[model samples]
Target: MAELVRVAALTGYFPTMQGLGADPRPMLRECGLSPELLANPEQLISARATMRLLERSAEVTGCTTLGLRMSEERALANLGVASLLIAHQPTLRLALQALTEFRNRINSTLALQIETFGEEIVLREHFALSSPEPHRQSSDLALGVLARFCAAVLGDGWTPLSVCFAHERPSPSEMAVYRRLFRCTIEFDSEFNGLVIAEADLDRSAARADSALASHARELISSVMSPAMRTASQEVEQMIMLLLPSGRATIQYCAESMGSTVRTLQRMLDADGTSFSDLLNRARMQLSSQYLANPRTRITDVAGMLGYGSIGAYTRWHSQMFGISPRQWRASAARRQPQSSAF
Candidate 1:
């Protein structure tokens, strides 16, 4: 689950760049991005890659407000399944609540928090990532998209009382874009990145809200959220991933987590052309490679994370899977990376 995001997270990027007279392919390739990989709305891409793509594209295209420009084109349908649920929510408050719960369906690392200070309410946008280096682009993208979401749910004329960002102030040209996009008092180098508005605004009911549709959509989104209906194997793999660090990546644990019995889980996995042991081992091998590639990670620490109780046992399993000791594998991985990226 290493902070992956669905490709729909970039729902408005392609058209935005094309309209701006920029060919995004070269920028994407330089950042190790593939346009074809984004064709499938349900396909997962590295959140890090998404962040890097935005930063590099902005730098290459000389668009200081690149992220904001892209997010302005976002629509309600860009939310995927969550759109149905959010569309019918009775009020802006409830819609944001739905977003807090279902944003994971879009980006696993995105976090939205709402807090009240007196009559003024702040809806903070932050990333729950470890050391999210170069976050300004993503932050602006999130803010613009959120403003669009609020306007879609409320009305196009609805605007926040103020929009804030922790990043330094933009250039005069960029500030003009920001003011035009937000249509509200824009504060830069603020205490945090969020939207501030009167609490009364949130309480206003949506003109087109439908309680019945919202209820049904919530049920469907909640039940189908766990598995994107991809495959039983992938479902099981994700389950094992969440349980591995807790040393509970067993068949019983995976089955229970998925609300199925061990027998039923095994049967479903078999029907999907996979076995529990094979899936678990594959997940471990993949995660091990990713973890060992980080120089700051210790082999013994990786072993514990992979559910191995002893370093010797972990080394034996590593050799069985890749025909090399973890140390040697890490060395090779380091050599393959650019000198400037060894971090």
Candidate 2:
């Protein structure tokens, strides 16, 4: 089975803003979640609960636009913190580097990575396990928010070079909408999901940048780090590493092994800012290196032990995570080995 993405603790960004003229309480209650739960930023809800909330919120608000709105809300709510890192860094590259580092503090599930390819800056989304159902919606929502957030930070005219998605082939309708929203090319069903921006855009100064503002933003993000650290979760991570070789691990199985209810296990993981799905992928990524190091292990067998349905799936995931095929990885590993000297 494909690994699940975790989104519990990260959902705390869905604040219950009383004055926003929309009562998020009824929506939360319907999903068996509470607005107060946001207070415990470490607390996590189940993927089921998160999906229900997303669907119900759309139903309640009568807005097909909730995904983008939620992304923007998250960006706006956290701008104070983001500005601190983005404002003072010596260059846009460094600012993005800091943003990538501190992204977990906001939502650990929103896996953010910055890559530079020639003149382009790519902000990739490694989706978390607990993201909303209909994975395409969640992926698109993430990309939309990121594009808007960068524009907000760098100035209104900022645009991306291209936006890419791993699933859902881009349609003309989506292309038109995406182009209108981001003013960039939208490529779907790509090898990865991320946005590509021109390198020059990073050098453009934000409308608001000053030492005092930068210092204040830094202080806020810094203060949150301690509390975030205190609540970090490692049990699921440990369990995931253990189960990767066996490849039969399920959420229920993991909970049983941990001696807890599934809900309890999920909650603990959420508090730690991760989920079973995220942990599994991470374990596979880590173990691929070890397994690939052994020439005796066939790529097919490695895929089976990792619980992949087929070697193709495993190879695709491996390439996405490590940027190389298993065959290539194994070949590279062999080349790096020191030869024995028979004196």
* Model 2: lDDT of residue 138: 55
Cα RMSD for candidates in order: 8.9, 14.1
lDDT of 1 by residue, 27-133 (tens): 77877778898889888888888888888877777777888988877888888888888888899999887775566676666656676889998886645443324
Candidate 1 clashes between residue pairs 3 or more apart in a chain or in different chains: none
- TM-scores of all predicted structures: 0.65, 0.54
lDDT of each: 0.78, 0.60
lDDT of 2 by residue, 75-145 (tens): 44443345466756645565666655555444444555565789887776643442223433455567776
In terms of lDDT, model 1 sits at 0.78
Displacement of residue 342 (Cα, Å) in model 1 is 24
Which regions in candidate 2 have their CA more than 4 angstroms from the true location? 1-30, 35-48, 55-66, 72-75, 79-83, 87-90, 128-134, 169-177, 220-343
Best by TM-score: 1
